[model samples]
Target: MIDSHIHADTRPFEDFELMAVSGIEGALTCAHDPLEMTSFDVVMAHFRRLLTVDPERAARNGLKLHIALGIHPRAIPHDPERVIEKLPDLLRNPSVVAVGEVGLESGSEIEMDVFKVQLKVADELGYPVIVHTPRRRKAEITSQIMDLIDGTMDESMVVIEHVNRDVLPELVETECMLGLTVQPEKLTPEGAVEILREYGTDRFVLNSDMSSAPSDPLSVPRTVQRMKMEGFSRRDIRQVSDGNIRDLLKISQI
Candidate 1:
């Protein structure tokens, strides 16, 4: 399955190398603040890096990387106008896939403004929006995100990521797709399998959300394997592991 969100800058290429060996098709590589010039410059840098690393990546059968550039809501709030200016030009890059890791958070007023701006940018261009809800406070965080999405984004166009046990019901009620990272964070593979069984295994996408710390677990396939042991049908395992992401990314295969 495609990792819908990732930051290659913070993690070494080695981590990605391992994931590719596990059957990851591609990871949409993303980054936040730039070390230098214009916002577009950051977009250019990720694309440059993706091009540079891709052949080496292919040699090792690693996940192919795609790039997306936009302000993350965690850094600031939603601001429609400012985002409008930044995102349109950024999307011009053919390697850039979507506008994201942007959305509501339990941040200050400024953060809300910035998120709204980027969300509008996603809407304007019809780009798929990758929404981030606060990991520290998943329930309160999800409420904030749901409110924003209800007012702005089409439910089908947004992918709410890093979903854990907390907002599972809200996830079903809102009918918004979810991205679950099964790496060695607070959650375990067994625990994640329980979630899939409870969540109905539809419209739920799996991701790895890798970094340098701990194992990536090559989460998609790992989760798929566990679900099978837990009595999940082969068809359901494939649905969450790969099928949903194909639909969410609007691509043929991961």
Candidate 2:
């Protein structure tokens, strides 16, 4: 299973720790382009300025760590374009998977502008967008994104993050996939179940979304277990596990 979103802000456990603990094959390590990776150095076992993970390290640990480039919302105020301009090169690497953790937020004016620029970049580069929709404006921001991508993107070319309650119908109508973070946070497990019931496990996906939160690393396994206990079918559980995520990321399973 792949954690569609994650931040490597820790030092004691590197990015693969999630897969190691979950007994899953891999996870996507969201490397924030704007934050000081050093500030959160204490959590990871080690910090490498790796845009794409080192295969040797990942193989040694029995996991695959896929990295993506994005400047998260909080760090958007920094010269985001300066940081963003480097993304295409990062995406050029065979291991770099996608182009976000991008999109609008009502957090700040800088956040909005920076997100706009990043959205445009993600559109231009043709990498799948990992969007964090605006607070309380899921419909509004999502509508705008739909309009923006209507003519340009293939509709399946973006991934909407479930940072909060999803506007599931709107997300589905937009022909995009929803990324549900099923980490160990309170309310997350239950919340994910609800979305799965509403959207089902196909277009919906499960991610750890773990960065600074005390959420469990084995979030996907926990999700799979809880989902089954909640009466979700094996096929549905498999969708949350790797089917939907691998499809959205276009990773080959065979």
Candidate 3:
């Protein structure tokens, strides 16, 4: 299991064959705000279909897709620095990892100057970022996205996704990486296992931001069968449904 946020190009290839028959091997699929960003070649043809047509339609319906390109502060276009100078040659595409569904929905000022220029281009290309936090003044826009990711980048390479429980006690004492997005309007596989039993699964990551709204493509294998009917360990449900997002996107094992 690894859904650390999904879109699979707005769902439907039978929901990646029902999220690979409900055991969901892998997924990432980020880059958002597409109902026309309107230029920079329509956001570089939607980041070249999330690097070539949504990883060949999630590997022909057996899942294992992964990619994360940026620009999603409500899909800002009209020359977002030419898609931030073409995101380091398409994030050195080896099925691109992160820079993500970037941050701040309406903390405007050009969405905080395009989320501080894509978090300074994912901290000058070291990569790993997925920061989206908005559902109307979510803890004051996540404290202005943790003050533009305080001192810029390396809050353990960022991940602050669609979290809840009113910003989980200030993002569980930040060092980033916490996504918990089960969707329906977010957070409800028993409120993402009650924020992993009151925020214990350190650096939590579990997702199904499966877009085109009203989602639940087997929301991370039905929240891993509700963390196995709430008895929770199996190494804490394999570290939030797959080893803290495959060790925060260093994803090696296929």
Q: Please give the RMSD to the true structure for each candidate, in Å.
A: 3.4, 4.4, 14.1
lDDT of each: 0.68, 0.65, 0.85
Per model, state how many residue pairs clash.
17, 9, 0
lDDT of 3 by residue, 200-249 (tens): 78688888888888998888778878889989888988888888888888
Q: Given candidate 1, what's the lDDT at residue 219? A: 70
Which of 1 and 3 is the better model by lDDT? Answer: 3
RMSD in angstroms between candidate 2 and the native structure over all alpha carbons: 4.4
Over the stretch 1-254, how does candidate 1's per-residue lDDT look in tens digits? 66666666656557677767777777766545435424444545544564456535544654666766666654432233554575687687666667776766565576676777777777778877777777678888788777777777788888888887788777878767887777786566787788877767887877766655464646776776788778898788777877776676666663
Q: Which runs in model 1 stand beyond 4 Å of their true positions?
A: 33-62, 76-84, 212-217
Evaluate model 2: give its TM-score: 0.79
Candidate numbers, best TM-score first, in rank order: 1, 2, 3
A best-first ranking of the candidates according to their lDDT comes to 3, 1, 2
Best by TM-score: 1
| Deviation of model 2 at 253, angstroms | 2.0
* TM-score, structure 1 vs. true: 0.83
Residue 85 shift from truth in candidate 3, angstroms: 22
